[model samples]
Target chain A: MSDHAKVIKKHHDHHAHAIAKPGKRLMHHVPLAFVLKKVLGHGGRNVNTALNLTSYIDFLLVTVIFLLMSFSAGGEITVDKSITLPNAENVEDVIEAPMVAVNGQSVMVDGTPAGNTRAIRDAGKVQKVDELFELLKRKKELWSSFHPDKAFPGVAILQVDVDVEALVVKSVFQTAAFAGYPNISFMVRKRAKAGGGEGG
Target chain B: MGGVDVGGGGGGKRAVNAEINMIPFIDLLMVTIAFLLITAVWVTNSRMNANAQVPGPPNTEPTEVTTPEKILHLHIEEFEFKLVWQQGSTVVAEDKVPKQEQTDKEFVKFGDLAVKIAEQWQQHGGHQDPSDQKTDQCVVHADNKLPFRELVGVLDAIYDKKREQNQADGTIKNVPVFNMSFSIR
Candidate 1:
């Protein structure tokens, strides 16, 4: 073969070898001394260099699904901070209605402060509080206006503190009844365990 | 996983670019996640219904009495609970559970009182009436000095006892034993 032809054949062979073995081609691009030094420096062990975003996203999806499944759907009543509901074994959830919260000091009707609990208690052996009755009466009137044809539903929720006087609670109940809210419900917290009664 | 393919070229490597179409899938997943989150919040704040009846106005007319029905009255005092079973005006069985007898060690006694009350109720044929078939009404008289927790405890005891009996009898439809109304007397 001629020298020019031989030189061309050698160059073509080198190119083909480089293309066929990409790892060797890559090694050739980087210095062998540098690669050896890195290997020795890291004790020839493979280091995790990339983050697996797919696996991370998969974990997050699983957590979200679990949270969604565990949640219970029911009517919610925003309990006031002043009232600590009595814990009961067989207590059910509160329905959607106007709430009358009685704490140690004051009574709140639908988040509005109606009167002091002590004052209401001190007002003799009364079955109703005038301020609370007025508030409930107003609510009933509004409800009646909104649904002109329908009768007043008369449902009201009483979220009372566990340590409050029973007479005070009774007064609230009677007052609510007299104000056209005859159906009264006491809101309570459900105990964690069934058939087990915990002290307040 | 991602990859790039080298296609045919003149002595040069040509990459065939490929990409995942993740926009639509990700968008759908995001929407679903958002919807699930909102639904979860709504579900967690669920409520249950409890009903109560107030005293009606005084009636001037007297009504004739037919068959006398059994009445169960539970009175919650400052440190004790009194359970009274009555048939019309006659007292059948009465029990008093003190706070001292309601300890964790003595809790069984508290429950036993409920069992005894249930037995008395059954003996008096309290469950036989057609009108009382599904009803378990009781008058709960609570003192002003009593804490609400004790009242709940007493109620729980009665309910638990009734449920236990019903389960033992293999009743198909189980109902609450004490459908209660509160009174201050």
Candidate 2:
């Protein structure tokens, strides 16, 4: 054989030696400790680091999804008026439109009078219960007219004063219910202050 | 024991490995924040009524302005409904719906008041001139302590009655929200 042919034969032998026998390969399992030591450094510290990374990624993913859900609400319907709303201990966040103050005597729609001249204090004069129906009916009509495609706003915020009796507040809800507006939300401050320290 | 050299493998070597790749986490957080902000903004803008047209100037001399009618302001004290109006205000009409004196329920007399207001609103002269119909806006000045329910009931009654009227007549009646202002006492 020529020198080049001899060199080629040696190279072919080396390549053949590199390929393992088919049946032996199945039995050639790396030791668990060997694999662990190689991948996770000497004392399993690297394994913990990798596990922490995986868990951290999971935590971040979950947090992202949670936050996305929290921040996606549209412009909040707000009622910026003088009427102070009664606070509740079991308060929940509710979406609403401009508030219509009902002090049990007079009705104010968006802080404007939409009813009779009934003083709140005078028990026999103004029929507030009857007036609420009128106000809700008007609001419903206005909303329907403006948003004729059934896009009328749903909830009405009632900023009933803290001193207003529960019966009066309940009447407001009843009026809203009758007016076909089922969602009536009581307005409240973030941090309770004033006379209503808790459970007003 | 399978005669494998397990004991000879270096198990005593210690190494510290606490470093973490925070790049992916930071990237994910940024993406999430951006997504939430965009969704919130989109939702907010979708609610804005962009098609609402501004009211233009009155076409000609207003009709209700010429009559100078006086509006009767009613006050609901603890027990009575009192009527109030300025001296020069034109007294269109004033009548009260008598209620059961013993009733403790704070129900607003919306239906009767609505009928009265509807009649008053209809009575305002719009038949004389076609141009004066849109300009007649009722100005209501209310006491501060009025119940929110009662007030809404009044507005609701006015709206319901008028809509009922329009539905009955089969003519589209656009009832303007009578301009209502408050005297916060």
Candidate 3:
């Protein structure tokens, strides 16, 4: 072969080899090596890689924070942490703690009757009258103590019969408020007209 | 030429390459948000234990009273309330509170019952004097299903006379009826 022709053939072979393995191979090697190499072996290569890591970590951290905040903000209010309230045919939307339940002649505290069976029928025995007030006073103190940052004189929840006389129900409030729980609330079944039914 | 070539290649080495893959980050965020929402809901749910056995405070003994006036015992039934004032076997008065129209009436049904009771109370020595008084207390036998607000309203009506008298006498206003008690069956 002629000298110029041989030189030209060798140059063509070298160019073909270069084309076979381009900067993509170098890029793949650099990224992998950047992950493996430390300050000792690859002088600051890991530090350069750390810059990318920081961006992803920041994204993860911000998202986590946002989620935590949203979770706390979306807390719900429930009765005894269990009973999803039932909608009533006639009532209002009122949420109260210490929900006093009055089923028939029974006077219940946190849904448990305070008096006995005979009293449940007659509902006139003054035997267990003081117990309800005493319980209420203690609860008022506890609620206040729970949120020591502020001052709440007392807390009570009064639930009465739908057919109960306004005067009779009023006397109950007067009695409770007189016992020092001026901050009282009433539990009512929301009127089922609106879509705000007390379901989950 | 060499520096220009390097600068042209450096366009691919932009600092924004370190930015997180936003799609994966967003996916994780959504999952985390859902998890937080569920947890918050759970935590808030366990707050009120409706089944908890919260009993009324225990009473040691009943105290003796000097003057024992007839006590009006009110029984709250499902559809109506029965009021009876009695001491021993003698029934002073027994009246049933009727059910009023409640479909569109803003006021509660038995609201008039309170008024009637108040009128009767006025007729029967319903004097309000902070200095001295007659009967020790008036015990109300309330039903467990009645709403607390109604109970308060009833009490307010019952004590309206005393409140008015107190206002006239210039005592610290809004004084609650101290001579009231409850008998929850």
Say which candidate scores most in lDDT.
1
Runs of candidate 2 exceeding 4 Å displacement: A1-59, A69-75, A79-98, A102-107, A111-118, A123-126, A129-137, A144-157, A166-200, B1-25, B34-185
Model 2 C-alpha lDDT per residue in residues B1-185, reported as the tens digit of each score:
11223344345774333344577666868787677666553212111000011234478866555544444454444543443443255554554543222211333334455445555555552332323343223333344444443443343333332221143446644333233322222
Interface RMSD of 3: 13.1
> Which pairs clash in model 1?
A72-B43, A74-B46, A74-B47, A75-B47, A93-B48, A94-B48
Per-model lDDT:
0.64, 0.46, 0.48
DockQ of 3: 0.09
The chain A TM-scores for the candidates, taken one by one, are 0.66, 0.45, 0.40
| Ten-residue stretch with the least lDDT total in model 1 chain A | A191-200
Please identify model 1 stretches exceeding 4 Å from their true place. Answer: A1-58, A71-76, A123-126, A148-151, A195-200, B2-64, B100-134, B158-174
Give the CA lDDT, 0 to 100, for residue A156 in model 2. Answer: 69
Which is the winner by DockQ between candidate 2 and candidate 3?
3
Each model's fraction of native contacts? 0.37, 0.08, 0.13
Candidate 2 C-alpha error for residue A168, in Å: 4.9
The backbone clash count of each candidate, in order, is 6, 54, 29
- Per-residue lDDT tens digits of candidate 3, residues B88-157? 5587777777644243332333445555565555444334455443432355555654554445444433
Clashes of 3: 29
